[model samples]
Target: MQFSKSLMLLATLATGTFAHPAVGRRQATATSAAVSSDWTATPSSGAYSTAGFGSSTSSSGTGVTYEGNVGNPYGSNIIQISSSDASQYKYVAQFTGANTDSWTVAIFNKYGSDGKMDGWYGQACLTFTLAAGETKYVAFDDDSQGGWAAASGSTIPTDSNGGYASTWGEFDFGSTTNNGWSGFDVSAIAAQNADMTVSGMEICDALGGTCSSISPDAATVNNAYTSAETDVGGIGGNIASGPVRLAVTIDYSG
Candidate 1:
């Protein structure tokens, strides 16, 4: 399957427009079916991405296309979050952080400008080109929200807007202002369900301890989410709020 685009004149108008399902109605679930390249989903099934920012939707497969923000908002090679504050953010550093080549990574926060479930996150708030071994961070506010950072390239497809689809590292931080918690999980649901490429990815704590990942080599995925496990909950990390620095390895094989 191929993906294309129809960009708007005013970039901010779309702000990576994500539609469908608000936060209160947002629920995660899945199956453990064998993965294939012909994955599809109805409106109420499988997870999909936003149609705003620099990307648009084509209503492919059964219903909607599992897309990403079309363009890189932070330009190329410009990482987001400079301080690397462990308290308000997590780092995608170390644990084989560098890739053989650059991958376009897009961040879709759990909420939109209006603070709702902006679908799969409307704005590509932090979009950039990530080089091999490069370090970057995404911040979390006091709101009861979380989101995902999707990286696509190598074997995946990039739309005309320069957005890459497939391969996602989902996260949520500072949930419950008084007693917040941070959680994370790796997922191949959107891509595998859309019959697109499912690149390997892994996420670990600051010291490369306790991990979750989608191993392309191993026949069995290690503590990660696949199309079959869409409805399956409690499949990720749940840590109390504090300093959290995650070590990420993109295109992981182990």
Candidate 2:
């Protein structure tokens, strides 16, 4: 289904202006890319499962868990996504770190930005390391296929008082870990713009070593988040000046 022009205009307005550089057609290019996508909440029954770590406090009594020394003083844990429709939209996983553990995200897309997995587009993944108890907004832009593209003229909205939003994603495994992170808002956009089929989504300790693609449904599961709002297309915030933050995640099953 196609999105309305009014909505497109609204999305453009929310991101300042759509005056992109004249270098390509109507598509997602490094110079003319839309803001990160957004999504709605999914129903309760379709949530997936997770595994890899325990919920108990870590050895340092930091109340965090460690999953195989990915760098958590607590124990270890991870969240997975392997849904069929997961490819139907773009997705971003949002997180907030508590201690000095490096955080990062990994991604594997079936279809690259222009539709090829190994094609060159733009920045496909992003990582953010937080200071002890620092709150910030970290978004993962996967539309770029040409290695790591930079997000120019884009800004992460801070709180009214200019304080960073206390949210982060993925943990320290470094960029080579193949598990880049995406924010919840960006996922909402991907779900609408492209036909991306996702096979793996995970969050683990980056320092311990590396992790493999486990099932989205694992043991010791907690709460999960998904979106039921289908037919999501085009940029979000079409009716407002600023984008609304949705701090939620969910497991998907094929």
- All candidates: TM-score: 0.57, 0.23
- Kindly state the number of residue pairs that clash in model 2: 57
Q: Per-residue CA lDDT of candidate 2, range 132-152, in tens?
A: 333333222221111111111
Q: How far is candidate 1 from the true structure (C-alpha RMSD, Å)?
A: 15.5
Question: What TM-score, to 2 decimals, does candidate 2 have?
Answer: 0.23
lDDT of each: 0.44, 0.22
Distance from true location, Cα of 58 in model 1, Å: 33
Model 1 accuracy (lDDT, Cα): 0.44
